[model samples]
Target: MQATQPLVGKETAFITGGASGIGRATVLRLAEDGFRVVVIDRNALQVEALVAELVQAGYDAVGHAVDVCDRSKISALIDAEARVDVMVCAAGIGPSCAFDAISDEDFRAVLEVNVLGVFIASQEAVRRMKPGGRVVTVSSRAALGGGGFAHYVASKAAVVGLTRAMAMDLRQRRIAVNSIAPGFTDTGMTRAMTPAQHAAASALEPAGRPAEPHEIANAIAFLASPRTSFITGQTIFVDGGKSLGGLGL
Candidate 1:
């Protein structure tokens, strides 16, 4: 790993949806960057393994299993954990189906996890963070457009809006809030697709490839760092330029 950045030392970051995928990558990135990391995820095994790995590596890391939709659990967790300098709300689900095909339960569930999850997590994080703290939420490039996945796109768009609003709301306290709008990437969720499906999805990228998990983690690290003090209320696209070309070409 590269030398840990100075802004990362002696600080703590709380992350949600951290058992696997982008959350796991962010946890490792933050740990490697010298921040004490606490992750909340629904996957007990994955969370436990990650925590153990970080411990063995001489880094401060712990994991909690909780549903992000539950406000009481979130409040209790934050109360127990006390203060954190950074919070990354990366817990979300993407159910891509046509608008009419989206069932009521599925639509609500997606909204709860993607939009309300960020709202609840950010609310708790703001309460626990110091004045110069940072909050980075994981939005999606779907926020910029609405197409095949109407429910997912709607929920993620709310994330972007919430991020911007929170940035304004938190600015007075010197706490920066931002969101990362990532394009397609190869994750466990995306692993369900056929090779042809994955290739076709990735082929839309102007950069000609899907992003690696580490790439997004690096962007989160940058946003969470004190060095990004001047940056806030923005959605940084780490999406390999896919958003630029909506065409299937």
Candidate 2:
């Protein structure tokens, strides 16, 4: 581990699903670290609020409301000449049932958000990124196995596959791609879990607690930073040692 420094200031980062959760935390972290952030989210109001907050803090940031699952919209978003230097594919969904219990519609929706969404965003970003650009996608420890939540797990496993594949394709271009698999974290995404369920999950972690959104954000920031240019095709686990705690969530 090295002391991290702000990358080239003129560089820009386009973050997807950046209105809340780990995405928003990454946006704030990147902006504060002296990178211009371009935030995209489905919630226009929340995106606006984030932009306003960043601007008030004297950070260079902007917000755009676009569905990452839509290819055309994603293409248009990255069509600018800004030439983004970093992309954080934090846009995803996990509120799904078990494989047999999930409806066709629900299963497709999960893949759309977790798998296809990352592909589209990465494709669009790659087209506009400089040679040394960085890309980091949010995955989950659930992807390691198919337990009760099959749909979510499968989708996230796809993310890890995509990360490795993209790294191979972009190696010649010097564009690094990686994924972060976080365990249970305290965020809007986990807010829906029953208190008892949350407690059970927390107890499973060797740390005896869940992680904060900022904790995950810090991992992502490291991957996106220029200091990590040599660290590609790796799935860095930020699960408070949970991945080593028997790999169950």
Candidate 3:
């Protein structure tokens, strides 16, 4: 592990999977909170576009093309800056396949990116964080369990577990580790559903609509904020009551 650097001027926030979806939304939200964000994604084109967009908005930002599951790539990234104030572990991929039909390779790929990827990112990022540093990870409401997405759900559950463990380990360092479990979010991933399927799926939620990326971003922003120091190892459900299942809360 590398020696962590002290945070300097213009607090820096780095986000994995930041080129699109929830991660992209997090980048913009943190930038608004005055972070010079570094967006990481394997999609070079999307990363470039996001960087350009941020610059156009007069925010300090940059892009890195990297895979979160690649330890070597991530090791190189852990030293990206002198100090990292916040790291959003948002890189994940969840593919759907029937339980019986799910290939070992396919399941492994999902876990690699969704589970191991978060672990690697958090491990490196936390090692590089200063005291009061923050890590906001993206889990899923499905971690509570659902049908048809065993691999993804299991991976997300792993994330929640990892979050608590990380919080305990980093407690002495004053680093907050937390996660957000989003449900029925409107994104490219949801867009893959047929229009009717999408609508019907969202209707199942008490909110009666899928969450916009920015809505979930709001949760990430709050968790990553310096003000959230007292809140650690908690999974904030941004899933619009879907986690409740008819239990009035």
Candidate 4:
């Protein structure tokens, strides 16, 4: 954990998994929106690349290579920050496996990354935050109920529940907590799917295509903005109507 550039008058946003996928998109979007962004990711090279890109683009940004599940390290990182105006929990893992065949180790791994990771990061960031701070979590539409990834679905469902509880607890402090549930999005995670699986997912989308990472980032940016002070404890679905569930007429 290297020392970040000084945070001037600008608000600071600390984001986990900000090296790629929706997390990377959010980092870019928030930086463009004028926040001094702090990116945390497990990949040191990716973190360096992103931070360099941001600095070259004239954005105040820094990157840290740390796993979100490392609670003590995450807490220390957040503690070192002058102020964390926003925290986005976007680190998660979703491996497809049949429920009957899912190993205990596999299921626990998903929960640790998806559920425990969010809890640790959010708790740490909020401790250093002021009133009106924001926390945006990334969940998935699979939480609504899906097949082949029981572990993922369960973890995301827990995130939604945690968001609601956090909102209630933090309401008096004027901090807003919300979540975004993205459908099949064009991310590295989704790109790892088999070709047939990818095609089937796209075909099932009512929008006839997977969401772009920026699309989900756009929604997250909105939730993290000052304008969303009134919106909390809600799950905004950026799933292109996949959650609507009625097949194409």
Candidate 5:
């Protein structure tokens, strides 16, 4: 990881699903970069534990057990903050199911967390953000195209569209918006896959391995930084060439 210059002042970062996986990694990276990180997640115990750890490490941090889809609660938290310099919509769910096996409820659940959650958080955060603010949404390489988890793919694709529209809308405000489309990453979510499924994913990766959460965080941190002022409305693929095509399945 490249060293980041400590941000001066009390610049605050709000990250949803920040208790684990990519979200957790981003929280640590942002905090290390000198942002006062505010972690929001549904896992109360994990939220408290992570915040405690950051505090013990001498980093400015706090946490709340809040679902990203809860607009009122998310808005209230953001409203309470003095200022929100960065917002990372890392909260998402991707349950793999065959298209034929996907029930309406299953599909809705994925959209609720993966799409609506990001929309709600980004909306509230953008309202509170000022010029030069940053919003980074987590999309996925699957958003490009995939077989299993149709709902997950659709939700992520929506995120990409939403990100582009946000960047255009916020250009006048000078707030940059971007999305990172990570490939197969080693996280609790990926670990949930059956061993065979996991092995297949890893084999498909051009790097011959799954990405570490911190690797995805690295791209996110770059987009979240004020230095990326001119870059917006883009989907960066940190997929280790998996998205380059011709994997020969």
Candidate 6:
């Protein structure tokens, strides 16, 4: 939460999956930072409501209902925008399915949203980004290890690789690409876990609890800041020190 004023020339930011969780928190934060914000998500009603809240709060903001995997819609939205200085790809899902029970369709579905969805958004964002622009994507700590959810782990790991490659590809253009690999964050997705499951997971974190949505959003804002110009192609883990060991190190 830096001072609520324009930074790096009042740049405009586009965020995906902005209806809730980390995405929602980031939308409000960047707006506070004085960027003209555009929130894109597949949830139409939620998007509308969020935009209305931002508008009421006096932030230059708009909302669009979009499935990130739909390139046509994404292209149209980016094309309509005059400039994009920051992009945050926070749309993703992590479902827990035992490897033995996982199916092809289910696996692909996760990849479709978590992996391809991010790819589509990042590709489009890179195209519309101005020089010095920043792109922050969401990965997961599970990417660093073999987890129970193979599909989720694989897809998130792909994001880290994609982010690094994108950082290299976009360096010539002076646009930085980075990722935040959050650990055990308490969001809607985590809330879906049963109390017993949640307790068991929370016990594993060195911090002994899940992260607040705003906590992760704060890291995201920092990475999206022009101040982080020297930072690129790295995945900073915001996992309450969970990465220090929690699972089979």
CA shift at 231, candidate 1, in angstroms? Answer: 1.1
Order of quality (lDDT): 4, 5, 6, 3, 2, 1
**Cα lDDT of model 5 by residue, 57-146, tens digit:** 989887889989889999988876778899999999998889999999999999999989988999999887889999999999988989
Query: How much lDDT does each candidate structure score?
Result: 0.85, 0.86, 0.87, 0.92, 0.91, 0.87
lDDT at 154, model 3: 89
Which of 1 and 5 is ahead in lDDT?
5
In candidate 5, stretches whose alpha carbon ends up further than 4 angstroms from where it belongs are: 1-8, 246-249
Q: Which ten residues in a row have the lowest lDDT in candidate 1?
A: 1-10
lDDT of 2 at 59: 83
Regions more than 4 Å wrong, model 3: 1-7, 247-249
For residues 120-217, could you state the per-residue lDDT of candidate 1 as single tens digits? 98998898787889999999988988677888899999999999999999999999999998888778877777899888887777776788888999
In terms of TM-score, which candidate is stronger, 1 or 4?
4
- List ranges where model 1 is wrong by over 4 Å: 1-9, 246-249
Clashes of each: 0, 0, 0, 0, 0, 0
Q: Cα RMSD for candidate 1?
A: 4.0
lDDT of 4 by residue, 130-178 (tens): 8999999999998899999999999999999999999999999999999
Give the per-residue lDDT of model 2 (tens digit) for 25-133. 9999998887888888999989988888887788877787889988897787666425578989999888846567888888889899999999999988987777889
> Candidate 5 at 15: error in angstroms?
0.6
Root-mean-square deviation of Cα positions for candidate 6 versus the true structure, in angstroms: 3.8
Show the lowest summed lDDT stretch of 10 residues, model 3.
1-10
**Clashes by residue pair, model 3:** none
TM-score of each: 0.92, 0.93, 0.94, 0.97, 0.95, 0.93
* Alpha-carbon lDDT of model 5: 0.91
